[model samples]
Target: MSLFLIAGIALTGFLAAGLGTMVGLGGGVFVVPILAVVLGVELKAAIAASAVCVVLNSLRGSSVYLQRGLVNVKLAMVLQVSTAVAAIVGGLIVIFAPVQILKLLFAATLALTIGVMIARPNGGKRVKSGPDPYGLRASFDRPDDRGPAEYVPQHVRSGIGLSSVAGLTSGMLGIGGGAVQVPIMNTVMAVPLRAAVATSTFMVGITATVSALIYAGAGLVDVAVTVPAMAGIVVGAQMGGQLGSHVPVKMLRTLLIAVLLGLTIAMAADGLGFL
Candidate 1:
C-alpha cells in the first residue's frame, strides 16, 4: 500500500509540475492539495512538501526560461532578498498558528484567487518587468519566438508592493506566488504581460527555499511525501516548460484560478474534518 501510495503521489507531482510550468507559476498549488487528498497528509506536512516541490519545480522551470533568455535575473535578485527574509518570518507564523485556523486561512485565500482571475483581463499591457525599478531598465529576447523585448516602468512602487505581497503570500501559504506577482507587474506596473509571465518563474525557488528550511527544521516535513514528490515535480516541470512556449498563457491562467478555488474548498473541508 505504501508503494502504491508513493507511485500515486509521484504521478500527481508530475501533473502539478506540468501545470505550473505551463502557467509560469510554481507547482505548489498543485502539489499541496494532492498530498492532502491522496496521501492523507496533514495540512502542515502537506505544506512542507509543497514548499519543497515548488523549489524543485522552480529550479527546473526557471532554468529553462533563463536559458531561453526569458528570465530577468536582475529583477529576480532584487526581489528575492526581501522576499526571502519575509518568507522565513512567514514560515514561522505557519508553525505557530493553530492547525485548524491555518487550514481555514488557506481556504479563504483559494477563494480570493478565483476572484482575482475573473476580475483581471490579460492581453496587451505595458509595464516595467524588473526587480530594480529605480532607474533600471531590462531588455531581453523572448523565448517563445515573439521577438525582442523591452519594458519601461510607469509605476515602480506598485511593482515592489506586489512582489513584496508575493513574498508574504509565499511564506503564509506553502506556495510560490508568481500568479499574483506576474499580473501585478504586467497590469499595474505596466510590465509587458509576456515578459512578466516569463520572468516570474525565477522567484519561486528563492521564496520557497526560505520557508522550506524552516519547515524542515521544525520537523514538519515528511520525506515520505517530499522526496518522491519533488523528484517527479522537477522532471515534470522541465517537460512542461518545454511545452510552455506553445500554449496560450492566458488560458492557463484562467484554468489556474478554478483549480486554486477547488483546492481551497477541499482544504477547508480537510480543516473541518470532512476529509
Candidate 2:
C-alpha cells in the first residue's frame, strides 16, 4: 500500500479503537466495515485485520479496567470458557462462508443488538442484593453520589449460553462479542452496566486472541495491515479506557446505544447493497 493509504488505515483504526473500547466492544465492529466497505478490501481480509485490532484494543482497554477494580474476574473466567471454545468453531465456519451471507449476518446481528439495548435501557433496574450461589458477587464505586454498588450475578446459566453466542459472532466477524455479552450480562445476569462493560472488555481479549490465532494459522492475516493498525489501536484504547472509567453508567449506556444505532445503519446499508 502507498504511504498515504497506510496512514488512512491507521487513522481509521485509531477512531475505531477509541469508540470500541469506550463501549467495551474492541475495534473490530468498526474496522471490518470500514476496511471492507470503504477501503475496498475483501471481506475475509478485513475480518483477519479486524481480529488483530480487536486483540490489541482489548488488551489495552482491559488493563485500565483491571487496575480500577471494575472487572469481575470470576464471572469473566466462567464466561471465557464457553466463549473461547465457541470462537474457534466460528472462525472455522467464517473461512468458508460466502461474503454476501456474512454481510447479511452482520447486519442482522447489529439490528438485534440495537433491540437488546432498547429493551433494557436502564440496565435492569431490579437489582437483587443477596449472597451469590455462583460466587460471582462483586462491587464497584459508582461515578455518582450513590457510593459503592454491590450485587450478585443472576441467571448464570443464561449468561453462559449468551456468551457462547457472543464468542461465535466474535470469531465469525472478527469483532469482540461485547455488543452481545454486555447486554446479556447487564439485562439477563443482573450485572451493573459498568461492571459488565469492564468484564466484557477483559473477556474479549481472550476470545479475540483465540480467533486471531486460528486466522493466523490459516494464513489470513496480513502483517502489513495489522501492524500499523495495532499501533494506533493501542494508543486509542488507552485513551478510551481512561474516559470509560470516569464516565457515569447512564451516560455510558446512552453512548453505547447511539453508537450501535449508527453501526446498524452502516451494516444494513452495506448488506442491502445501498452502500
Candidate 3:
C-alpha cells in the first residue's frame, strides 16, 4: 500500500479507537466495516486487522479506567473466563464461516446493541441500602453532581451467559465483545454505566488477545494493515479514556446509538452486496 493510504488507515483507526474506548464498544467495530466496505479490503483480512487493533484499544483504555478506580477487577476476571472459552470457538468458526454470514452477524449484533441501549435509557442510579444480591459490588465517582455511585451486580449467571455470546462475536467479528458486554452489565446486571464501560474495556483486552492469537496462528492477520491500526489505537485509546471521564453520560449514549445505527445500515448493505 502507498504511504498516503497507510496514513488514511491510521487516521481511521485513531477515530474508531477514540470513539470505541469512550463508549466501550471496542474499536474493531468501526475498523472492520471501514476496511471491508470503504477501503475494499477482503472481509477476513479486515476482521483480522481489527482483532489486532481492538487488543491495543482495550489495553490502553483499561489502564486509564483502572487508575480512576472505575474498573471492577474481580468482576472483569470472572467475566473473562466464559469469554475466553467462547472466543476459541468463535476463532475456529471464523476460518470457515462465509463472508456474507460474518457481515450479517456484525450488522445483527449492532442492531441488538442499539435496541438494548434504547431500552434502558437511564443509568448510573445510586444504590440503596440493601442486602448483597449477587456479591459483585462496584462503585465509582459520578461524573455528575449525583455523588458516588454504588451498586451490586444483580444477575451473575445471566451476565456470564450473555458475556459468552459477546466473546463469541468478538472472536468471529473482531469487535472485542464490549458492544455486547456494556449493555449486559449496565442493564441486566444493574452495574452503573460508567463502571460497566470500564469493566467492559478491561474484559475486552483479554478477549481480543485470545482472538488475535488465533487469527495470527491461522495466518489471517495482515501486518501492513494491522501495524498502522494498532499504532493509532494505542494513542487514541489513551485520549478516549481521559475524555470519557469528563463527557456526559447522556451524550456518550447518544453518540453510541447514532454511530451504531449508521454502521448497521452500511454493513447490512455491504453484506447484501448493496453497498
Best candidate (score: lDDT): 3
Query: Which window of 10 residues has the lowest lDDT sum in candidate 3?
Result: 120-129
Looking at candidate 1, what is the lDDT of residue 116?
66
Off by over 4 Å in 3: 19-24, 117-120, 124-135, 141-149, 238-262
Error of 1 at 9 (Å): 1.5
How much does candidate 3 score in TM-score? 0.84
Give candidate 2's whole-model lDDT.
Answer: 0.81
* RMSD versus native structure for model 2: 3.5
TM-score computed on alpha carbons, candidate 2: 0.84
lDDT of 3 by residue, 205-228 (tens): 899889889999999998988898
RMSD of each: 3.4, 3.5, 3.3
Query: Residue 268 deviation, candidate 3, in Å?
Result: 2.4
- The local distance difference test score of model 1 is 0.75
lDDT of 2 by residue, 1-275 (tens): 88886777787788777766665556777777777777777778778888877877677668888998899999999999999999999899778877878887877776776676566555666355765777887888777868888888888988898899999999998988888888889888889888998899889889989999999998889877787778778777777767867767567667767866776777677777887
Between which residue pairs do clashes occur in model 3? none
Sum up the clashes in candidate 3. 0
